[model samples]
Target: MEMQPATDSRLELWHELMQFYIREAWLLDERRFREWLDLFTDDVFYFMPRRLNIHRSEPERELSPVGDLAIFEDDKTYLTMRVERLETGMAWGEDPPSRTRHLVGNLVAEPQPGGEVKAKTAFILYRSHHETEENVFAGYRDDVLRPTAGEWKIARRTIVLDSNVILAKNLSVFF
Candidate 1:
């Protein structure tokens, strides 16, 4: 049994996507919300479905489906509004502005039709707030990246968090 090496195109695509994720993470960690928003397309769909404890016999019932009860299901417009709210000085939960570190790894990308790439990566998002508050979230992101003006923009992102219940007081920080 032999394993074949990846083609040049595939390798290049991987490198490009990896760099994209790195820069996105950097932007988020720096709390550069507006800059981070630029990485997403105008019609981007950002979603995180809700999860529940289910019986072993009903595996598919563990996670809620899209358009159902979701932890987050923000379109680009909603995302922009959220960013705007954060930019203002009145967002209560983010008054102090939490420090965050977003780590993305284990990228797996496949080319889609019409110059798009569907990629998935495992991520760990750590957030620390004033004195005693801290939160850590681990998840996998299924993203559809579209090529736009010589760069890649996230057209869709579906975050599947590992935890069924959120322990954090507030989910103000972006994932």
Candidate 2:
């Protein structure tokens, strides 16, 4: 995908892409896992690498996604299994279900090399379980979206969380 000149039409396209993110957030917040899964491509690579706060002198080793730990490194198959588990209503972590709100903003979209879009967005997820205090997670996501059947589908996602240490007990909800 060659770089197109910025124009009013490009702005409109960006707005449409933003709408996709909004819809995705809604689906997740509503616990419509199946619908949310539909937004992803069959070859989606969703990852959330570990965020480490190290010495500034070794900035190169701060964040590692390769040969290191990660919160999530899921392919489409794993994502499907997660959704199926949720549907079974037997996932101990989410059996009671958590009330969640997903807020997405600061979206920026750029055309990639193969008719794909590289989009970045800021996200904040709030979750309230039965009798537990609300848990808040803040992060930013870098996504590669492919146009499929006249709609955009997430092909890849790399989420970088803001916190170095997660305070939540279980990360059952999608960020």
Candidate 3:
């Protein structure tokens, strides 16, 4: 079916959602992991499954299945642990700290039932550390956002990275 133009209210909601995502990116880029974690609901599920470089005919094997290994499959508690680990100054992987820039764009949001909004956004994350380490991760995210206390919170998020093989030594940076 052909897509119809957004209504005025829809446009306004879209703009607000886009701004929310931009704010999220800023928080991560600023290394404010606690603040960024606050954006998610207590029951949030953040997942990033590994992709398979398979032929188009093997549709069932494209993304890692439910029981397969994923780069990130964290609940709120696990996410908190990650943030805490980074704060201890003992995470050797982040000893030098990675400077990152998160570029978020091409957002499309639609209201879902039960007072939630499902939004998809494209992102390009650039991370540089040490003297010459640099890695670029490009992907789009599917997020389910719920409003609580007049603010939006991520109830679920699935990050679909484009590449099959990640070159980064460790995914220490939050996307």
lDDT (tens digit, per residue) of candidate 3 on 24-135: 9999999999999999999999999889999999988888965789889999999999999988999989877899999999888878789899899999999999999899
Query: lDDT of all predictions, in order shown?
Result: 0.90, 0.89, 0.91
Point out the higher-scoring one by lDDT: 1 or 2: 1
Q: List the residue pairs that clash in candidate 3.
A: none
Highest lDDT: which candidate?
3
lDDT of 1 by residue, 39-107 (tens): 999999999998788899998988899868799999899999999998788997888889899999999
The residue pairs found clashing in candidate 2 are: 1-113
The runs of at least 3 residues in candidate 3 whose Cα sits more than 4 Å from the true structure, single-residue gaps closed, are 1-4
lDDT of 3: 0.91
Best by TM-score: 3
lDDT of 2 by residue, 1-175 (tens): 3455779978897899999999999999888899899999999999998889999898887778655778899999999998899888689888889899999998888876889989999999999998966899998999999999999999999998998988898888997
Per-candidate alpha-carbon RMSD to the true structure: 2.4, 2.5, 1.5
- How many steric clashes does model 2 contain? 1
TM-score of each: 0.94, 0.93, 0.95
Order the candidate numbers by lDDT, best to worst.
3, 1, 2
Q: Which ranges of candidate 2 are over 4 A from the true structure?
A: 1-6
Please give the lDDT score at residue 44 for candidate 1: 95
Tell how far residue 4 is off in model 3, in angstroms. Answer: 4.1
